[model samples]
Target: MILSIKNKTLAAITLLSVISVSVFADDNQLTAQEKADGWQLLFDGTDMSQWRSFKQPTVNEKWQIEDGAITLTAGGGGDLISKKTYKNFELTLDWKIAEAGNSGILILADEKGKYIYSHAPEIQILDNERHPDNKLDTHLSGSLYDLIASPIASHKKAGQWNSTKIRLENSALTVWQNDVQTAKVTIGSDEWNSLIAKSKFASWPDFAAAKEGHLGLQDHGDKVWFKNIKIKELN
Candidate 1:
C-alpha cells in the first residue's frame, strides 16, 4: 500500500511539470481568436522567414532564435526588414535590452535607401536608465526617435521585457509602452515637419518620404531580444 501511494504522488508531480512546460512552449504563438481578429505573427519566435537583412537576399545569421525570442548579437548583424511592406497597421512586440543597450523599430522604412534610419521614422528603444542617449527626451525608450518625446517615461529596467504597441492609420501615429499611451502625432503635418526640422534627421531628404514601406529592426551593436512580434493591417 505504501509503495502504491508513493508511485501515485510521483506521477502527479510529473504530470504537473509537463503541463507547465507545455504552457511555456506556446509563448510566441497566436491563438485561434487572434487569427480570427486578423492578427499575424511576425516572428513566431523560431525563425526569420518573415524578415531579411535590409536590401539583402537572406536573413542575417546574427539574428538568432533562442528561448523563443529573436536575439541580436552585438556587432553581428545588420538591420532586419520585414519582407512585406505595410502602409497602415498595428504592431505589437516585447523587447529586452542588455545593460546600456540600444535599438529601434523603424516604420515606413524605404528599403532602397542607403540606411534604414535615413528613410524611416524610428520608435526608440534603449536602456533609459543606463544608456547615455536617455538624457534627451526624444531619445529615450518609446519615443518617436528624435522627433517626439514620450509624454510618460514608462520603460522597464534593462534585462526586463517591455511591451510596446505602435499604431498608424490615415497618417496618425500613436505609441504605447507598457500598456500606457505615450505619444501621438500626425505624419506629414506642419507640426510633424517642425519637429523634424529640429532633429538630426532634418538634413536627410529621404526621411519620412514614404507612406508605405517595410518595418525594420535596428542593429545598434548592442544585445537586444524581441519576441511576441505580431501585427494587424488596418484599412
Candidate 2:
C-alpha cells in the first residue's frame, strides 16, 4: 500500500509540472483566473483586429503579426492605436527591440491628433545600452518620456524580451519595467503642467489634454516587437 501511494504522488507532481509549462508557453492567452478577473487580451498573438492606424481607416501594412508578435520592420506605417479608448486601466505587454532601436508606448493618445506624442504621454522604449537617447535620464527605457525619469533602469539587453506594465487610476500613472516600478506621476496636476512647460511639447495645444483615449505604439523607423498585450479596466 505504501509503495502504491508513493507512485501516485509522483505521478501527480509530474502532471502539475507539465501543466505549468503549458501555461507559460502560451503567449497572449488569458488564463481562467485572468478571465474571471476581467482581464482582456489586446493582442492574441494572431491578428491586429483590435488596432487601427492613427488618423487612418485601417491598420497599416507596416504593422504585421509575425512570430506571435505585432512587429514593425523598416518602419513607415505610422503609429498604431487601439480601436477602443480606455479611461482608467492596467496594461501589460512584452516587447523586444532591435539593436539601437527606438519606440514607445503612448497612453491617452488621441487618434485625431496630428501626432500621438503631442496628445499623450509616452513610456519610452529603447535599447538603453546602445541608443544615444539613453544619455538623458528622461529618454531612457521605461522613462516617462521627457517629463519624468525612471527611478531605476531595468531594461534587458537588445534582442531580449522585457516585460512592461502601466497602470492609470484616478489620474495617477505608474510604470513598471521587468516587474520593477520605474516611474509614477499624476496627470493634469500642477506638477504635470510644469513638466510639460519645460519639455518640447510646451507649444502643443492639445498635449496631454485628453482624459481618455486610445493606446498607441510608436513607429520610429526601427524594428520592434510587441506581444502578450493585455489590459484590465479599473473601477
Candidate 3:
C-alpha cells in the first residue's frame, strides 16, 4: 500500500505508543530491565511469603491476598514485616485506604522494640481529608510521620490507589507521593534530632536507629490495601 508522509508519521507515532504501553502495563511484575537492575518484588501477586507478622513466624490470617493486593482485614493482624532486612535502599509500593482509614509504611523496623513504631520511622498513609490524623500536617499522607510534613499533599482520595516511593541512602531520606516530591530529610542529623525532640518520638531514643532492619506495614486496625511492593538495594 502507498501512504503519504503525514500518514506514515501518524502510523509510526501510534506504533510507538502501543509498544510503550505494552512494555510497562503489568502490575506486580518487573520488566526485563528492572530485573537486570536488581529490583526485587516483595509481593508478586502470587503470595506473601516474603513477609510475616511482626515478631511472629507467620503472617496473620487476616492479612490476606485480595485481588493481588495485601489487604489488612478487620483487626488483630499485627504489623507485617519483611523477612529479610535491608540497610540503604529504595522502596516503592501502591496503597489504598478505606474511608477515614489510617496506616503507615515503616522503615528500619526491628523486633527488639515492643511495637513496630518504636524503632522505625514511618511514611504516613491515611485518607488525608477525613482521617483524624489529618489535624496535624505532619501526620498527613506521604509525610515522615510526625517528623517532616509532606511538602505537597499529593495523595489520592480514599479507596483510590496512591503510589509512594521512599529512598534512604546513607540516611539521606527522600519521599515521593504520586510522582510528586513530598518529603526530604537527613536521618540522624542535627535537623532530624531537633525535629524528633519536638515530636511524639521524643521519648523514644532509638526511634529509627537501626543500621539495618526489616520493612514494615502497620495494621492500625483499619482496612488498607498494598500492592506492587518492591525494593532495590543501593550501594
Report backbone clashes per prediction.
Answer: 0, 0, 0
lDDT of 2 by residue, 1-235 (tens): 9999999999999999888865554798987667888999999998899999888889989899889999996789899999999999999999999999999999998856668787889999998889888888889888899988876657678899999999999889999999888888798889888998998889988887888989999999899999999999999
lDDT of 3 at 128: 84
Question: Each candidate: what lDDT?
Answer: 0.88, 0.89, 0.91
RMSD of each: 4.4, 2.1, 2.4
- The digit string of per-residue lDDT tens for model 3 on 13-117 reads 999988876578488988777788899999999899999999999999999989999999888899999999999999999999999999999998999989998
- After aligning candidate 2 to the native by TM-score, how far in Å is the CA of 215 from where it should be? 0.3
Q: Report the lDDT of model 2 for residue 198.
A: 93
Better of 1 and 2 by lDDT: 2
Model 3 bad stretches (over 4 Å): 2-18
Clashing pairs in 3: none
Per-residue lDDT of model 1, residues 1-235, tens digit only: 9999999999999999887664443668876667788989998767889999988989788888889888897566999999999998999999998999999998999867788888899998998888888889989888999887876557678899999999999889999989878788899899998998898988988788789989999999999999999999999
Ordered by lDDT, highest first, the candidates read: 3, 2, 1
Measured against the true structure, the TM-scores of the candidates, in listed sequence, are 0.87, 0.92, 0.92
